[model samples]
Target chain A: MTHQDVVAQLIKLVEPYAEGRVAHITANTGLTGELALDSLKVMDLITDVEDHYEISVPLNTLADIKTVGDLASLIQKHVGNDA
Target chain B: MKENPRLLAVRAVRQELATLGIDPFGIQIDEILSPTEGLIQGRRTILAGTNNYLGLTFDPDCIAAARDALESAGTGTTGSRMANGSYAAHRELELDLARFYGKRDAIVFSTGYQANLGMISALAGPGDTVMIDADSHASIYDGCNLSGANTIRFRHNDPNDLAKRMGRLGAEASHALIVVEGVYSMLGDRAPLREFVEVKKAFGATLLVDEAHSMGVLGEKGRGLCEEMGVLGDIDYVVGTFSKSLGNTGGFCVGDSDEMEVLRYASRPYVFTASLPPATIAATRTALRKLAAADDLRLRIRENAARLHAGLAALGFRLGAPANAVVAVLAGEKVEALRFWHHLLKQGVYVNVMVPPATPGNESLLRCSVSAAHTPEQVDAICAAFASWPGARV
Candidate 1:
């Protein structure tokens, strides 16, 4: 699947955890911003993402991630590598 | 207004806790009367928060050994184990731990944190995958990060969830490292070791159980939860801390794996850090022997755990898990938990106030660690303190 496709699906996953503050979750939506997710909620989101794609994301990768697009790109890489 | 998300988050949580005008983390025990009693603030308090399960801290044998070692061995080791610090006692303790578990070999680290970091990083590198429980300690998470491995967190204490995650790894499952704790520190609940061992075997994976809280508290022999659960032999690696049950300092890792000794050279945490102090090593050795020989202490702790658990329950407070040693009274919300902690303190009872994200889920906990040192009256007195709180009905 394309990175854009992953981003679209990720938007759906990120919505419920956004605390109703973000009306739209674009590819560039800041995870620490619009999502308003605390550290614990971010972890919950990561767990959901892993379950959805059945791919493991390295904990180190979170250091480089800030936006939904960055996460989608990383998730896409994991998906491709696992495939 | 800070741009740092981590700091901002902590600041927010701290503000909620700060409103109560008490810093639970900064509590100072003016004097320690025993393993179960201490002077906190100005009051003579029941020190329920200490993780002194075996209560060997003030044992005459332990104190005497430490004193003798201090006189003979000077103060510090002054070197790392890989360097000049592999004192005779360190290796002897390692051998003792290995023999205790019937493992082929063991490696002792500076602390339990380093034991996990050193072992996990050495076992799994860039190409490997690590499956850990979601509720694992911060040290375990740090180990995974340091390893730079593909880390997947399975549902806490759920073998089925782990199996699915391991299955998803495909070929990587064969060598994946699975980490779980025996008697998780937060709620004090134990892992289903048998079910986890079955999953490990099914996936052809390695299992590591950090029995930090369970050792010297569980099993008829005071080995750990792995022993109590009848799957001690199935675990590939067993790591634990002396700070808790041993009532001292330092950490250990015992395993029958062929590569156990090889990790000594490869692990940065082990190869670099200063060795444990001679006194701590000596005291722990004596404590270890005492823990092994005494079944009465273990039974005493279990009884105390049950009494406190039932006492708090009778007061209508919700407990996190069944009785065992750590009894967490779940006080929902950060503000409420903080208030409850102060209440306990005012009544001459002290428990570790746990808040998110340290605590699992959103439940704030008053974590009470039972000790063999506590008398039945002391345990009842602690429950009475909780019962005195008007919010006990929750």
Candidate 2:
């Protein structure tokens, strides 16, 4: 799957907790702002994402990942199968 | 599949720091002098960020006790308590702590962190649950994690939220250990002990209050929130540390003799970790003894905290919680927080800089922890430094 496809999947996962359009989760969309989720909630989301993709996103990677696109690229780069 | 998100996260943290024009982690203090003063960047600074609440670290009585212990007991235990490490001083300290709290028993640990870790983990296991406040210290979270129990958090200082979560536990709720702090670390707000006690009683759940920051800072004679709130006997467990107000390093769990005594043998963290050193036990004993009658010091400390809070508030800086020993200034973003911290350091005042991951909702904070040793002038100096900073208000 492409980076966009991965972003779409992750966006869907967080959509239930988010506002407006999931597609608006751009490369610069702050996860905390877009989803109105706290740190622990984001941690829970990351756990779900890790389980779904079978890829490990380190704590450092989380610091770098602000938007959906950045998250997708991280998964792609690490797991080599982003979606 | 081979990549490690953990290492990547560290690198990402470095990258993020670069982008934000700050350092995620930097600087090292050669020595921390006092709660109101320390040496940073080769300059003497007013230390307003340390959790040295009672200012007993440099007390003559405490220092003499520690010195005597060092001469008598050496530097370390160098072995777990279950091994050959439980010294006479350790047992005496435990007994003293129990008597001080008016509890039947008290179990001591190497550090405050391990006290929660050992007590919470041992009391509640995989099948049980640990309910904590969202604003609890990291040690509490670590304890819950170590327990292998299902952990849940209630909203900060909200008894209703705690009740709602307890209701979900159903019959298994009795096994849940509801934990909270007397004075929260970040915001410096006291827990609603009476309401929380009522809620815990209603649910038939056990309770544990970490008085790490409140031990000698509240209550008549400094017994902490339980005594001050008049719910001391009703609560199941009272856990606290000597590091903060007591001005030493160690942790203890005090409660009814029958149940708390069992933890001495059952808790892995307590049994496995080397016993606290003689010096710590000795100094802590002196501190605890003085604590039971140190109303004057507690009053002065409270006055100092209030003075700082009122001063900061007057300057239009958004203070955290109420006028308490801890005064947190909101900084919104990491870059701005770093800049504010740097500015404080340059002004010869040292405060803690907390940002995302560590802080709730990734909100950056400049936290100032007050102590009894802080004079009115020092408090005024700190406030003046903060007011002088243009970047701090935002």
Candidate 3:
């Protein structure tokens, strides 16, 4: 999948946990700051994304993820590597 | 002016508690009257959060053993086991624990936290991977951090997630160490040990089960989940604490692996910390023997847990898990949980208050632990206290 496709799917996966802050979510949205997602919520989001994409997102790879755009990029990279 | 990050966090938490008009942490129990009752805030309170599963804390034999040891061994062990602290009692307890679990070797640590810290850090190192449950206790997380291993967390209690993660690692999966708990303390749920064993065998990875909550609470012989699930021989390491069922203070790791003995020399947590006092060691030894034969206590605790769990659920409370000794009542918001905890305390009952980040799913929990020693009347009182909560039935 393309990066934009990854971002769109990511937004949908995280929206429910966003707690009515869905409108604030975008490619540039910060998972912690903008969405106010705690570590546990972030982990749930990561798990959902992994299951949806059928790809592995190692915890170490999540260290560099600060924004939705970064997460999308990471997912895309993993998908590409998987393919 | 710059402020310490830790202090800032503490201030924020304190402000929230102050607004809620409750202080649930570090509560002072002026007197422990029995295994199930205590004097808290000048009131006779039922202690439903002590995690004294077998209720042997005040057993006459245990008390006598502790006293005799205190008189003979004096007050403290001033040195670490690696130094002058490996007293005869410590070694004897280790041997007894090894035999109790039917394992070839066992190593004792001063506290349960150190058991996980020492075992995980010593078992997995650089170039290795540590796969743990997302809801694992903090000690396990700390151990992973100290291991210098690439750590990954699978969805809690989901063996499929663990299998998939292990598959993704390919060759490195062989070097992975999968860790899980026998009975999770917060939610009182159990891991799918049988399924996990299959995954571990498939991936050629080692499995470590922390039975801190299950020891003396499960299995015919009280050897924990491994024995209860008929997977004792398959588990690579079984770690547990004496603070819970044994009602003493210490931790141990027992296994059949020859490498287990090397941890005595390698684990810093074990080598550096002072050994448990002679009195504690003596008491734990007695407790262990008693626990092995007290199948009736196990049955009584489960019965008490069922009574309490059903009572709370009937009163319109959402439970985190099923009927277990550790019955966690789900309270949606932190403030709501604090209110419930305070209400229970005022009604002469006490339970643990678990809040965000510490509790999984960002949920708040009023964690109630049942003990074998609690009378049926005490259980009824505990239930009635919850039933009496304001708008509880509504």
Candidate 4:
């Protein structure tokens, strides 16, 4: 999947947990600031994204991700890679 | 002039507590009346937050043992175990703990926090990986940080996530150390130890179960979740504290592996810190003996836990997990939780007011720990206090 496609999928996955904040979710939206997602919520979002894409997002990968765009790009990179 | 970071942090915390209208930190109980009751703020309060699970803090035998040791052995050890410490009582307690868990070796530490810090850091080094639960206690996180290993957190209580993370480690999976708690301290939920054992075995990862909350509260002989789940032998390390069920202050790590003994020499936290006082070791030894045979105390605490959990749930309070000794009542907002906690205190009941990011899920919790010493009437009074709180029911 393309990075933009992954971002769209991420927004949908995080919407229910974000408490109607999906309207503000975009590629540049900060996961913690704009969406007010805590570490646990971020983990939940990661789980949902992983299950939907059938890929494992290593926890270490989350360290460098700050915005929806960063997460989307990471997910895109891992989508089909066996690692 | 640039603002001092320390002062800035203190002022920020003070402002936050001022806004909440309650100071829940470092509450001083003017008098501890019993194992389960105390005088707080000049009012008699039911002590529901003290993690005295077996209620042996005031047990006659334990107190007597402590007194005798204090009288005979003097006060402090004055040095680390690697130095002038390692009194006879300390080694005896280690032997007792090792025998209690049916493990070959046990290493005692100054506190439970140090136990995790020492064990985890000593086990996994720069070349290794440590996989822990997302909801693990701060000590575990600090331990992982100290390990210098590439740390990864799997979703809490999810073995599939753990397995996947281990799989992602590729050839390094065998060097991974999987850490989880027998009973989580905050939410009072248990790890699926059986499933975790399977994952550990499949990945060839070493398993460490911190039984700080479960020790003397679960299993036939109260060895903790590993024993209760019938997978005691599979657990590579069993870490626990004496502060909870044993009613003292110290920690231990017991395992059958020969490498466990090397931690005594290699673990910095253990080598550098003063050993537990002679009195604490004596009292813990006494408590451990009682814990091995105190089935009645275990039953009472469990019964009390069930009563409090059921009563609170019936009153429309959101619970964090199941009806365990550590029953966490969820208050979605920090301000509301502070109000609920203050109201309960006013009603002669005391519980922990936990706020994020200290609590999991950024949730606020009125964490209640049940004890065997609490009477059924006292449990009802605690329940009634929660029931009467306007914010809690909502």
Candidate 1: tens digits of C-alpha lDDT, residues B324-391: 89999998877777888899999999999998778888778889999999999999999998888776
Rank all candidate structures by their DockQ, best first, as comma-separated numbers: 1, 3, 4, 2
How do these models rank on lDDT, best leading? 3, 1, 4, 2
Candidate 4, pairs of clashing residues: none
Question: What are the TM-scores, per candidate, against the unseen true structure?
Answer: 0.95, 0.84, 0.94, 0.90
Error at B394, model 2, angstroms? 2.9
Candidate whose DockQ is highest: 1
lDDT of 4 by residue, B61-92 (tens): 99999999999999989999888857988999
Model 2, span A14-68: residue lDDT tens: 7765646445665556686565566676765765676577554433346667776
- C-alpha lDDT score of every prediction, in listed order: 0.89, 0.82, 0.90, 0.89
lDDT of 4 at B81: 86
Deviation (Å) of B6 in candidate 2: 1.6
Order of models, best TM-score first: 1, 3, 4, 2
> Between candidates 1 and 3, which one is better according to lDDT?
3
Query: Per-residue lDDT tens digits of candidate 3, residues B171-267?
Result: 8888899999999999999999999999999989999999999998889998888899999999999999999999989899999998877877789
